[model samples]
Target: MSQLTTHILDTSAGIPAPGIAVTLFVLQEKEWLQLAAGITNSDGRVNNLWEEGSSLPHGLYKLHFDTQEYFERNFTASFFPFVEIAFYINSHAHYHVPLLLSPFAYSTYRGS
Candidate 1:
């Protein structure tokens, strides 16, 4: 079955974006319903956002990153108030979404 996971890296600091808040949501008919939310660990990873053995339905999903709070705590300024990523899940494999972020820019891609 399909599984969901995520990781965050702070490019500006050249380290993992620890303690950052992340929220996962599934898009329904006309609204986005929250599925799970958690803060990143020291390694900046939420490897199991969903319950183990649970499978997600194939559709569009979103991940919200609380960049502002993370930056403020470290005495940094960020251009993007928040970061949101929308992606499609289409198989019974693990989806690893990794965020590489700086103060003014960020990038993400499907990871292994």
Candidate 2:
């Protein structure tokens, strides 16, 4: 498992948000460097954003969820074009960031 991971749950639809694009970035100097990107599977999880057992340096990181395309594909109007969550990783601990989403709203939190 990568040190970092994420999943999306479409609360409005009461199911996993499959096929959503998730991107990972690391802050280098003053730029956000693209680290990895993947589309969610049927379970809404991207488990291969990085090589299994890979460790990342402690720094600022961000996850971008492409919400607009997801909503468009399902023919649902959404409020936000996309969702960006910036977080800090201070150790090699596994980080699970999950998103709870709806058409007009979304929420995220640090997960186990």
Measured by TM-score, the strongest candidate is 2
Which TM-score value belongs to model 1? 0.95
- The TM-score between candidate 2 and the true structure equals 0.97
lDDT of 1 by residue, 62-91 (tens): 999988999999999889878999999887
* 51 Cα displacement, candidate 2 (Å): 1.3
lDDT of 1 at 24: 97
Q: What is the C-alpha lDDT of each candidate?
A: 0.90, 0.93
Worst 10 residues of 1 by lDDT: 1-10
Q: Where does candidate 1 stray beyond 4 Å?
A: none
Error of 2 at 20 (Å): 0.8
Give candidate 1's whole-model lDDT: 0.90
Identify the candidate with maximal lDDT.
2
